[model samples]
Target: MGKLGLVKARHLVSRTGMGAEWATIQRYKNLTMNDAVAHTLSYVDYTLPRPPRTSSWTKTVGNRKSVSRQRNMMRMSKNEGAALQTWWANHMLTTKTPFLERMTLFWSNHFPSTIAGTKQPSALYHQNVMLRKNALGNYGNMLMAVSKDPAMLIYLDGYSNIKDDPNENFAREVLELFTMGGTVYYSENDIKNAARAFTGWSIDDRTGKFINRPEQHDTGVKTFMGKRGNFNGDDILKILLQHPRTAETIAEKMWKEFINTSRPNPGYTRKWAHIFRTSNYDIKTLLTAVLTSDVFWHPANMGGLIKSPVELAIGTMRTLPYRLRKNNLAHNLSLMGQSLFAQPSVKGWDGGESWISTQSLMRRSGLMTNLTRGNLRGKHDPLFMRHMPECSDEELMAWLIPVKPLHPLPTQPGRQRLVRALVLDPAYQVS
Candidate 1:
């Protein structure tokens, strides 16, 4: 791969790290594949923003240590959550490497839940944290963690389930969406049976603590995946994780997220599947194999995928020499159908072609104009710098929108005209 190829690779992985800046890419310019893999993994905890303040319901519990009360605290107002979002945008743009942030964003979509409904900003933020923590670890462990996540619990109505009448939402989604992708690894009978297993799974109203009420649970044995047993939600997850289809489903997602190519390379997927299962689902090992694969850096794949709203928003922010605020940044992302911690449904956003449409393209174009013209105020206000204190105009343009200039900009011109022409160009519409 040449310099451009390196830039492409860095951008692709930014889905795992958001989009690493040019300076960060330059640091690893000469690293061998193995060395680069190690270097990247070392960036899991590269840098982070301060924790955001959470919401608290008026019905306050004096005991701050209680999960219910804590959950309430996490569900702060939109204004409060804005601070945290700002922190995130700043960190991602400025971090030496944002691989974990990008990876967390990917998993958030994959496992898709919305904190908006639950009003639990803290739990939502915590779920994001958990995703980052395990984004590149063990799939089984991560799945289990997501299953119990407070944000997920509330988002999927797991908190409303009881022994007498199981909600069935979480149980159905766990098999159909989270692990198996609705391929009949499980059946309706299995869903009913699984719901019984998860009876009494509820959360504290004020505090967001998950509780298992034995009285609400059905202890009767039932069959799942052709196996007969009294299975609970955890048992269902375990069965799915142990199934071959489970491995296949997860491997396919890895292929799309890291590869982002049109069709899946089954040969590549299978090679990684064997490694994933053999290594007990180690994420790092699987990613290492994929990233080091020859096809990942191929020229044919460059700019082949459309940038998700999140990617377009963050990539622009990182490349441009500017800043943004939390609310404005969140607002732009929301307009793009990818607000952090707020997905449309349990299935999450269907990536790839789903992000492209006439309306979406228009919104992206509008955002570009606003960003470059200093008209937009996101998490980091002034997300662009027309007057670089040090670098020349050409260098600033190259730094900010390196993918493909929206237009051929003059070295010096009215910032308004230059930004408008470049942002309106088709290249800015694609990655």
Candidate 2:
């Protein structure tokens, strides 16, 4: 078997563990690749920790945001977002189901929406629930769930859609960004039809629940993608899945993440697209196929992806033992440009090289410097056990990435300095 422990640490875990956690992977050294993959998926069945519900933030029974409530909502939502990020970091650091968490994060960006823009924390929390619930389960079910998600309804202006005036924001994005992937694959006519198909699709303002208003719905025929008949949001999704281009778009997206590169290998992507279509969008089936595929382990695609802020931070927390307060951890990440649910736009953060700019890199290093020193606690804060001077530079890199290295780390230091350097290195910045 290939290095099951190494592959698990690199692709699945947010940050590979050290000490006892590391030992557990080594203990499975003899596990076949198939067995190890099965082990990873089985972990997804484990129960995850739940954060406080955002719906409970208010005392009033109705969904109205009173003047005082609005003021509190503005202030408290920031902390709520931070706490959620902290919970995510803790799960990545400690859970056996890191692959599932990783998938949850992937879907979060793939269906990009932000709590800051929604102005309703409860909706955002539930949207996250929707993503996690179907992270590796089924893309079609996930699509249906997100199409009716409260946070998504607010973010995409689905609440504004009505029989009298169809709002095209959500429909346009669903086609351009979510399914077809670009304008070339669809036309403006398709967008209008899709929007009309979702008329009266809105959320309950008080409870942040999805509700279909029959009176507001246009129960007439919608010519979506040239197919004519009375159709609604669910029907549109089913129709969209029938298009071969939609399957190709999803496969290409997943391939980018799996292979760690922006460039598409058409031959390999088409293969996965076939699997996705034939499997009826079974997410776990496609992912399992990709992970077991030879392309995933190719040297050209390994260790080159730039780490998003969440990955950079969570990886650190996993490798080292630190009990950082969730709020502070969230604040630090915000400064680095990724604030959990507060994405800057509906398109989500531009990953890859976009994650690194001159300013952001400095900020990233600064964050690393703070974590290395004891900013997590007080001055001279105790975190690590001792120096790992005996660990070769090659070995250290192996802990963070899947590829064999071109060279060893030039700088050698005590355990603390090694960590600081690793965290700051351009190599460590990537997956």
Candidate 3:
């Protein structure tokens, strides 16, 4: 309702963006909550650095077909995938629109296509662009675009689907994961019918784009969701979009994403779903409802969510002057279980408390330790200190730690020392 002061501003920025950036928080601290949310949704940088070099689809497919060249293809994919990961990691660290990147990451996980799965980094690069472009736009449009994305077609075996033999992998995931959220709402017959409807959808071998093979398509009438018609892939997507559970699935996911890890309140999710559906599945509309909702600003919900590896590592770098000793951030992220573009499965990372296993906690602590190792000494780095906001210790504490420090603050007085202690504190792992 009122101005989002330092505390509320940090909560909003840290949760939405990569981290609670000091300059952004400072600017947002002066604006009303509604204005701040609007600014976040409106501001975005679409420019991306030059993409890493990757083999063309034709070359990749040819190499895979040859026994001698298969190993070479694997090597090429491994090398190119690493480069792709670094490119995105670097962008996340330096992007002006971290929230856009965050939403892109969210959708990437939601509709995952992997380097190993596709073995086509070029296709994956284009897929990343598509996801970011529609990250805050229409969910329906994004779903349609992703369904036709070459990387998804290859990764999910949609490219191999034919009328004579319909591979139901894509259809099953669409029903169970993407649109409906689970198997309860749909039947095996529904999945089979959906797969039949999508028979002709495939990637072009030479140009690596979506193409429909009409002769290979199942043109006969198919009964899907109790509606009989001569349906195609687009028709199947339209039917799912019209389903109420599609909106509810996204709304529930938003609850876990922005709100907390606990089971979503159905009442709140239903209300948000209504807003999302009424707005024709506009992502910004759903985000507005989520951000302005009372639950988002509730005192009990503060620090309720654990930071993912990206948030913990890149967020620390963005928030403070700490930098990784090595330039292997992408590798470090993979080690910490949030590898870019390489989700563990179609379900992606389980996130939340699952991020804090004994092994991962050690790695997370090690990362924080290494990043802040330079500031452990009693004295402060003048360069780092100069970059810090000109604020008192209390304000610094509020800005750095979302909740009260779980560990006691260092009694000694240097600002850098205080920062190091707060960052390493257990409380900093959440929010």
The prediction achieving the highest lDDT against the true structure is 3
Candidate 3: give its CA RMSD in angstroms.
1.0
Which digits, one per residue and each the tens of the lDDT, describe model 1 over residues 1-431? Answer: 33333554354444345544556555564565567667777665634567766654323334245776665445444555566566565565656556777777778888876656656566777777788888878889999888877778877878767776778888898888777776556679888888788777766655666667777778898888789887777887888888776776777887777666477788888788788888888888878877777777665654556678777777767754534554577677778776666678777887777777788777887787666665333224332334322445454344334366645665555554554555567755444
Per-candidate Cα lDDT values, in order, are 0.67, 0.71, 0.92
Worst window of 10 by summed lDDT in candidate 1: 379-388
| Alpha carbon RMSD to native, model 1 | 5.5
Top-down lDDT ranking: 3, 2, 1
Q: Which stretches of candidate 3 lie over 4 Å from their true place?
A: 377-380
Residue-wise C-alpha lDDT for candidate 2, range 1-431, written one tens digit per residue = 66555555444333222121344455544565576566666666446678755545234223344664666666566666656766655666666656677778788988977867776666676787779889978898899999998778878999889989999999999998788889997789989988988999887655657899889988988788878999988999998999988888888887767667577788988888889999999987787777778777565656656777777776566555544555576666777887778777877776777878898889888777766664222224343544232355565556644454334543544555555555556666766
lDDT value for candidate 1?
0.67
Error (Å) of candidate 2 at residue 388 is 6.4
Please list all clashing residue pairs in model 3, or write none if there are none.
none
Worst 10 residues of 2 by lDDT: 12-21
How close is each model in CA RMSD to the real structure? Answer: 5.5, 4.1, 1.0
Overall local distance difference test of candidate 3: 0.92
Clashing pairs in 2: 63-206
Task: Return the lDDT, model 2, position 82.
Answer: 59
Q: Which model is ahead, 2 or 3, in terms of TM-score? A: 3
Task: Assess candidate 2 and give its TM-score to the true structure.
Answer: 0.86
